[model samples]
Target chain A: MLHTYLLSIQDQDPTKPLESFGEKLSYGGQMLLLGMATVFAVLCILWACLVIFKMLFHDLPAKKTKTADTVEQTVTEPVVEQTDDGEIIAAIAAAIAMAESECEHVKFRVVSFRRK
Target chain B: MLDAIKNFLGTTGVAQLFADSNWWQYLVMYVIVGVLFYLAIVKKYEPLLLMPIAFGMLLANLPGADLIHLDFFFDDYYISVEGGKIVGTLANDFTQFLQAIPNALYSITDSSIVFDFSEATLASAGTTMDAVNATFQEFLGNAATLTDGALHIKMSHVIKEVINNGGLVDILYLGVKLGVYPSLIFLGVGAMTDFTPLIANPKSLLMGAGAQLGVFAAFFFALFLGFSPMEAGAIGIIGGADGPTAILVTKELAPHLLGAIAIAAYSYMALIPIIQPPFMRLLTTEKERKIKMTNLRTVSKVEKVVFPIIVTAIVCLVIPAAAPLVGFLMLGNLFNVSGVSDRLSKTAQNELINIVTIFLGVSVGATANAENFLKPQTLYIIALGLCAFIISTCGGLITGKIMCKLSGGKINPLIGSAGVSAVPMAARVAQDEGRKADPSNFLLMHAMGPNVAGVIGSAVAAGVFLSFFA
Candidate 1:
């Protein structure tokens, strides 16, 4: 019954000002119901689509397994140790010196090597 | 030399104000502008937009500044064109038509015509039909025609006049009137917002929709208060708690009410941290407030990328009127989530939105001249806007309570208030309340689901109003 009223109200031109108090009341009521219903309906449809997206993209477990497998392989793999090359060490020192020269107000020394 | 000095003095703003009967009104406007400045600066309330808006008000109210002429935009004149030429005698609605003629001339010629007629020319022609006709004939020349096909002049034509002759702020106001700035701001909001929580819990969208209670409720109240349907719709949108959406809806539905509605919407939005918490506590039990739901699942990159696309298609399909706002919003989100358009995303989120915000704020502010801002309806709008915000908060809380019961006490009702869509502020209030209740509960992520959903919900509500009224 309310649906029929909504349909009827929808047909009326909303821009026209309601002259009678009762007509304005009725129209306002119709607008409230219609506006709420439409807002919910649109969002609900979006909600349903998101749910479908969740179902379609349910590859989380597969991706997790792949990541786990990579971790395992990395742990089992042998770590290669390399002796420091004099040329590379000297280049790194020169770069640090250049940087230090640019910021002459600050003094610093290379304390240790860290891999990030 | 003495006569020339006296003439210049007569033309000064001080003399104009002294001669005008409504000088007190300008003083009142200055006080209001000062209050707005205090709110924007000292109180630190939404200052990014508020400061510009207040300054714009100051500009508009300064005596004899001539910065904005509201009469230029008034919908009082009609154009009758025959064979692509204007037909009306200048004597008929001539004063009103003078304001519209530049625009009409631009429309017909497809180029702006400089209106260089001296004030003396207009004054001499005065209300004499033959004299005014001769003046128009001199101006229009071959462009003038005589017949009768009446058509209401379009707003675009009105805007053309502003472009040709309106002051700086008046030209900038075109963005608000044409519905450009709001949609662009939405694009930036989309880029900045994260939809992960919403994607993890799609049901949160319902809570967002529930929060719209205030909008429709306010509309009903405004209508009961004897505001026209268009005015009521504009008033009701203050509940959306989304500033751009309110501005967009008000601009289209009731441009006359734009200043009052924009002030109400933004002020209420800034006050959300204060306005929403009481309603939140009143609507939910301490037990319901402490009930923390499980953590949301991590949304994958693929899902995030697909979310905006799917939402744009679904929403625009259902409510095509929402396409301008929703479409740009999704496009912005897609730019952010796509992970490949970092520069574009950064620009939209920062530079583009900032520039548009200044333009949107000041122009909207310029609309609030003494005549419009000092009205009784402005007070009604402010009151109704507060009612809308409170009711919306309650609506979200009520929905949260319902969902809590349905979910067997897994959902915390406090998070529901975040559905009012004041963005992170509403979500933060929910978190603050949750922490006070349980000391360890973290509702921020959970609340965000509904927080972002409220943005979409409000946009959709605006769309419904546009479809109904625009």
Candidate 2:
């Protein structure tokens, strides 16, 4: 009788081979690891997809040719001051002269400057 | 005078009210509600959500009231007070308040009508039984659960209980029970959100993924602590620090634990400033905190418009269970960026979200009756939620530190802690820490990358858990 009861107690749990928190702990650990792996995998794929998408669609910078590089002198913007209209005009004149030199064969025309 | 006195004593619920076990529970719940009110109002701890929740808790725990009871929708649930005649004491005890009631009021079967609402379905306790009996006959064999061979009650026992049974709060609770409120809230969140940071620097997605370690860790803890797997899932998602996500997961996994989990999640979110900084400082060195990230390239309008569509496809395909939340979120973002429908975007961001927030907060609060809220398990849930938040912050910081080193010191570890999905709040904390370390460092926009990614990461984790447990 005692032997049968003990067997019944041990065999009662049909779901898992382990008992109580032990079974849950094992399953929880597996899920924990799996959850972390899946989250990372999903996010990483998203990250990669975004990178690829951005790169594929992004406007690639125009390739630098010898003439293009020679003509394209990087001009820094002059910081504007409230009362520096004289200095601003001088800076504009210098930029115009440089641009005129870049395309020496073209005739230069000036337009009126109106601050909006 | 002697007859009137006898009648008052006989009709009043003063006898059974004190005799019931729920009396002390109600008393204690009142005190608890008072504290919540003080915290929400004076202390301003998440007052937007907390104030309504606290008021709901107060309404639910008020003695001698059936404003938020689980009674059915039969005609017997109400009392007829037409012509000011005391014809019925259906279920509620009106006592002296009966004089203040309207000509007609709906009362529960076993109580007298104490309040008045023009919208209520009214009947007499004594005279309407026969007619109500005829109506009850249609639902007689519809649904009933056997209880001690006497009282039989269940869902089909009532028809349209959402509207008929619940006076005010119960009507709002329908959104919460059906998971509509949280999903709608996600739409508003999506509209308000700007994903440019995440788009500019996609690598922060890994840090967002890292922060979710706290979510699964807490699940493990809850299981060991003896919660069922479903209950553990609800408790665990509080670590995600995303209130709507927590509500959605709990509504699926363990609806019973919803109130406690929602309260813990929102309360802790409000406390992020106090809760996260210490762990962040403890996890990383001063030098690492001072590292500044280079400026992100300006994201174009096309990228913004298409980003939501791609993310929705990937997330939904990967975790179909997260479709309502992540799908709505992405949809909201699409509406915002597509710029075709300014009306829809404005609605989602402001009017729709604010309305849903009110319903979600009060309804969630109403679910926490004295019976459920006043328990040892509630304390355990609160503690476990706090631990989960702390561990999640630590996880993000730890990953940030590693990433900072791997990038040849380009990444600031401070931004990693923002990966726990508290939105601009967590990001702000990172910026604050960065500013403290070096006055010139501006980490706000940089931290936003991981912060927004954390939202997606948590939603994905929620989907994974839902697949397992739901």
Interface RMSD of 2: 11.3
In the range B1-470, model 1's lDDT, one tens digit per residue, is: 99999999998888988788888888888887888789889887789888888888888887789888766665432334445444443224433445534332223432222233345444553433344445555544333332221223457657767887789888888888889999999999999998988998898998999999999999999987778888899999999999999999998888889998998898888888789888888888888888877867767788999999999999999999898889989999999999999999999999999999999999999999888888899999999999999999998988888999999998998988999998877887888788779866767778888999999999999998988778
DockQ of each: 0.27, 0.19
Local accuracy of candidate 2 as per-residue lDDT tens digits, B26-138: 78887878887887888777888888887877766665556665333323343344544544333233223333333354343433334323222334333233343334334
Q: What lDDT tens digits, residue by residue, belong to model 2 across residues A5-85?
A: 334333433212234766677667776877788899999989998898688654432223345655755855454433433
Q: Name the candidate that leads on DockQ.
A: 1
TM-score, cand. 1 vs. native: 0.80
Tell me the whole-model lDDT of each prediction, alpha carbons only: 0.81, 0.76
Runs of candidate 1 with Cα error greater than 4 angstroms are: A1-3, A10-16, A64-116, B77-151
Classified by CAPRI criteria, candidate 2 counts as: incorrect
